[model samples]
Target: MVFYLTNLLALLAVFVILGLSFNLLMGYAGLFSIAHGAFFGLGAYTCGMLMRDAGWGFLLAVVAAFALSGVVGLILGLGSWRVTDIYLVILTLAFQVAVVGLFANLDITGGSGGLVGIPSPSVFGVELASPFRIVGLAWVLCAVVAVIVYYVVRSPYGRVLKTIREDEIAARSLGKRTASAKTGAFVLSSALAGVAGALFAVHLQFISPAEFGLGRSIEVLSLTIIGGLAAYWGPFIGAAVVVIIPQALTFLELPNSLVGALNGMAFSLLVLILLRFRPQGLLGRRSEAPVGDGGGRFAPAEGPEPAPSSAVEVRPASTATVSRDGGAPHSVTAAGAPPIEQPPPGDGATGPQGRKVRTLRCENISIAFDGLQAVSDVTLQLRPQQITGLVGPNGAGKTTLFNVLSGLLSPDEGRVLFGDDDVTNIAFDKRARRGVVRSFQDMRLFEGMSVRDNLLAALTPTAHEWIVPIGLGGGLRRPRAARADRRESADQLIDYLGLHDHGDTLARNLAYAEQKLLMIGRLLATGADCYLLDEPMSGLDQSGRDRVLRLLRDTVEAGATICLVEHSLDVVREACSSVAFLSDGCLIAEGPTEEITGDRELAAMYFGT
Candidate 1:
């Protein structure tokens, strides 16, 4: 029983490391990586081959393997520029398969017979042997990793990573440079896995190419899925389960094929359970300040990303964990303005005669979808520094107008011009690159990332070309650039939304009001002259509604033209100078908010008496 338990724990140790590292990328970072085998195999091979062929010390060879794995990870980081989720899975799969072929084909790897005689680690020249010793060492290593990972998750760096995973677009808007963050995550995660692989090689003293392949990759993935996505200890629980289950079955004299089949069946059942029930995983809370041990009110539950223990103490009674950084509270006013959040360049709205130029003009804009005219003959002009409200009943084409103007959907017959440039045909992403941005009514925040990083990532340009030049090829030739430049902006925005205390809180953990305003901060980072906000006040309570109105007023005061599609008369009265009412895709009224507010005909259109 002792022997069986030791072996089970041993196997579980390897998978715990794999799952933790994998979570760093997949769960917390919002990536679906399948390159675990390649990294693991490379680390294992490098350690085994170097020690065996060169007669290098066991520890030295492990270091070499770890370095080699990191290099491979850096090479793989290039994929972050243009891939995600399914695409990433495919890329890593290809790499894993290719590595297996290389191990088989290469003469150095002993070509299928595998590397043998890999001596174990020695403490001052003492060979590390015995299952008991191995388990102790392995657990120690895992503990160290957990500690380091804990810091990483809670650190500002991890905050940004979560932001990228949660909403890459939002992160880009906040100036996070999603590509750079994603690449960094890949390297970090791979290095962790590489260390694990090196240890495995040391333990076995015999290496086979088969030990590292898609099967192993699948195994690590299983650990993550079984334990939990965005779960800190889910990896450990998952590893124990997969390892122990197999070992238990083996003790029962199950055939090898039957064991594999059973694992498949068990994994399938887990998938179903996760889909139907808690999709986040066991040991995983849904969202983050931290929860009590019992799991009630799992709001703002931290993921693999650790909380700032020093910055804020976990108070079970409090809904927020207040960060002591600058003594900022949970909700505070925005810090008036930043020193460098300059508006869009070149078209600064200055005319030849020194008067401000017209920033936007929508003349007779019309759009149709499937023979339904969702927007028609909508004439509007957006000037510098004004808040405009677009209101109508449900299905009145308010969102459609935003979509058309933001370049998500093209208008059938219309002229949409911005600062003397006709961008009616521009694509949505291109418009964003050129400083035209819009937020969705659905509030698509990255599900598991912290609020601070979400805002920071939103400040970066999302285009891969701009992003790629910043992180590689001498990192755009920049010098001493810190990752927290937009942090001030993000902080200010967080303060504005009363989420300064929850800056490190995951997006999924935020109250409904918080998510709505965070999206606004994301839009603010775009530095667009013309803003299109769809249903900005949809779910806000009375206080949140007032806060949003203040934001709109302040935004317009900051010299930007905002088009808000909302239903709140008080908000419209408070923030909007001009109002455009849409009915069944047609512009029925266009005037001042006060003029339209008392209009009986428009009142009849909405509130039937």
Candidate 2:
């Protein structure tokens, strides 16, 4: 009984490692790879071959297994750069099959006969020869892995993984190397799985191709889902349940074949029931309801609604006078806050010469989709410290032009210049790093994160966003001063955007206007010099519009260039100094806002008279 119990505990420990490592991809990074079992098999074979052929020690063999698995995982992760979702699922599934087949055919791996005589591991010359010793060793390693995973999930790097899971595009737009992050997650997760595999081989003293197969992959995934995704104790709870269930079934005195079938049915039934009733799993958190959902956690407290007109009014603690680039002073007050006090110029606000800013210019830029021109021969320039409006009718190529300028799409015909440098070939994230950023019409905020966290995620050059630094220094590697500054900046932005009270609220929980403000806050956090805003004032009330206009004015005054894409001519006239109008993928008119709006022919075209 003692030996049986020890064996069960060791097996549980191995599965726990599998569960935690797999969660890094599926739960944290939102990647679903079915090749985890194949990686396990790779590790087992690699370790077994090395120890048997090369006479390597247990520790050295495990390290070799980890390195080999990591390299293979890196190759698979690179594939993720090209495909995702169902296509990625298919890719991994194919890989799993191929790897299992290779294991069954490779002579070096002992082929169908499988590898045998994997020696038990030793610590400092003390052989872990007994089941009790092996259990203790396995659990110790399991505890270490758990601790490592705990730190990783709690670190800034983990936050980036979650951000990628939530919205990869938004993360990329904020200058995150999302592909690299995903690749790193893959390599680390696979390496850990390899460690588990090595442990499994040593514990059993044998490894068969049958042990690591599609069913094993499904079993790992099942345990993770059953325990809870993104929960710390989830793997432990899940592995325990999975191990205990099959053992418990033995008490029924069923035949061996019947026991296997019944166990599979039990797990499948449990998964179905949990998915229907408790989708988040036993330890997973329930999704928070959006605000105004009948007094949900994020709902506004029971109180009289504030007057709509006063919603955007700033309520600073004290009044102050501020100016930008020695410009005219603006009175910043608390009550009835008419003019907002512009904060100090950000790093991207001005060039070396004060108030000098880089201009974004597109020359003869054209692009087409499905043989239909979306933007045709558009030549435009957005000058520094000014708000330029890109106005157009529906399907007029305004958004297409924005996409080209922001590097989301490359123009078929011409060059994009940022000041003197041509940035036509730069990636969108690279362009963002060069101080050009944009906001989406759909307001792609990280809905799972709080408003403050949204802004923090957008803050560039984060110190501990890489695995190496984070693993080496742990929490101390996160520069405290830099983190504090980012937090302070996030707080100031929350207040500036009139979202002070909603800083802790999830982005999805905010009202429509508030969510819009948070989007702008995220843009500001990127510290970009040029902003391309798409329908920023759309669906906003007068007060909300007023707040955005004021913020734009402040940003322009601080020496940043802006391009506003707006449908409302009134808003364009009120907020923009220059306007470029597009109609049917063509640049119909361009010049000062007053000149363009005053033209009767252009007015007719705009109003469709």
Candidate 3:
């Protein structure tokens, strides 16, 4: 009985690690890979071959197995950049099938018969022949993996993965290298799964291609879904239940054929029940479904309750309320100009320590999609420390132009110049690093994270650290200087945006107005020289509009260039120093706000004559 118990525990340990590995991709990175089982088999075969043919030690074999699987994982990760969603699923599935075929047909893999006589692992010439000792080894390794997982998910790097999972476009806009992050995560997951496979090969003394099929992949996937996606104990609970059910069936003395069929059926039934009843799984949070019912409109929840009329509203910090660095706060009176925040020295287009501010120029840029022109030969120059509103009709391609400037989309013709240098070929993330940042009209805050985390993620110095290993200054080594900077910056944005009350709340839970502000705060965290705001005034109440306007004015006054896309002519007339109008993807007029607004033909086209 004890021996049987140890065997079951060992199986549980193996499956637990497998489930966690899969969860790292599916749950954390939101990448549903179908090729995990192939990597597992590769690890097993590599270890088995090393031990049986080359007579390598167990520790060395295990390391080689991990590296072997990781190499394939890195290759696949790079390939995944070209595909996404259902296409990615198909791509991985095809690779997995190919791997199986290779394993079945290759002579080195022992053909279809599979590798046999894989020896049990030994430590220091002492064989772990006892089932209890094997179980102990498996569980210890499982515990180590669990601890690693715990740290990985909670670290800033883990937060970036979650951010990628939530919204890849948003992650890119904020300077995250989504492709590299995804690739790194896949490699790490594959290495861990390889470890599990090596343990399985040693314990079983053999490995068959049949054991690493699509069905096995499905089984591991089920472990995570049935337990939970983002929770630590989810894999253990799922593995425990899955391992025990087959053993329980043995007590019934069923026929071998029936037992195999029943085991598959049992897991299928459990998965179906869990998904139908609790799609978020046992430990995951329940997300509200999008309210898109037939008609193409999303009925998002309404904004937060209105502030009480009697409540004292805190005004935005301005030149009067706060000093630049360490100067006396100026006083304000009725009928005076609103307080504006002074630009920090050594920031924005300006050189470090209050040097000259640089200009960003778009030189006759044009882009098309499938022969349909989106943005046509448009040329514009954004002056230093000015708010230039890009206004046009619905299909004038305002956002497309913004995308070109921010490096989200490359123009088919022409170049973008920052100061004297042409940055037309720069990648989106690099552009962000070079101080060209943007805010989405959708307000793409990393929804599952706190407002503070959303801001912290924009601090590029620590954002890339997610891929580093724990001991090598990954999540384990918290750089006090970098962390302190992020915290200090995040706090300033929180206070500036009046998000102090909701700093700790998940971004998704915030009101729409707050979410929009949070997005602006995230852009602020980047300390960009130029800000491309999609729609700064849409959906905002009078107070909300005022707050955003104040923030924008303050940002510009602080030596940043802003190109805002807005539909509100009143806002453009009131706040913008200049306006650029577009009609049918053509730049019709651009000049002082009054000159653009006073053009009769432009007004007629803008109002749809």
Global CA lDDT computed for model 1: 0.68
Give the candidate number with the greatest TM-score.
Answer: 2
Quote the positional error of residue 540 for candidate 2 in Å: 2.3
lDDT of 2 by residue, 487-584 (tens): 76667667766776778887887877677777876876666778899999888766667667777776666556789899998999888888898999
Give the higher-lDDT candidate: 1 or 2: 2
lDDT of 2 at 395: 88
Candidate 3 clash pair list = 343-558, 346-353
TM-score of 3: 0.88
> For each predicted model, how many residue pairs clash, with residues at least 3 apart or on different chains?
22, 0, 2
For residue 518, what is the lDDT in candidate 2? 79
Identify the leading candidate in terms of lDDT. Answer: 2
Q: Show where candidate 1 strays beyond 4 Å.
A: 1-9, 123-126, 129-137, 267-277, 286-382, 389-438, 447-518, 521-532, 538-547, 557-561, 565-574, 578-609
Cα error of candidate 2 at position 452, Å:
2.3
**TM-score-best of 1 and 3:** 3
Against the hidden true structure, what lDDT does model 3 obtain? 0.77
lDDT of 1 by residue, 301-367 (tens): 2233222221122223322111111221222223233211233324455522233434766789988
lDDT for position 240 in model 2: 92
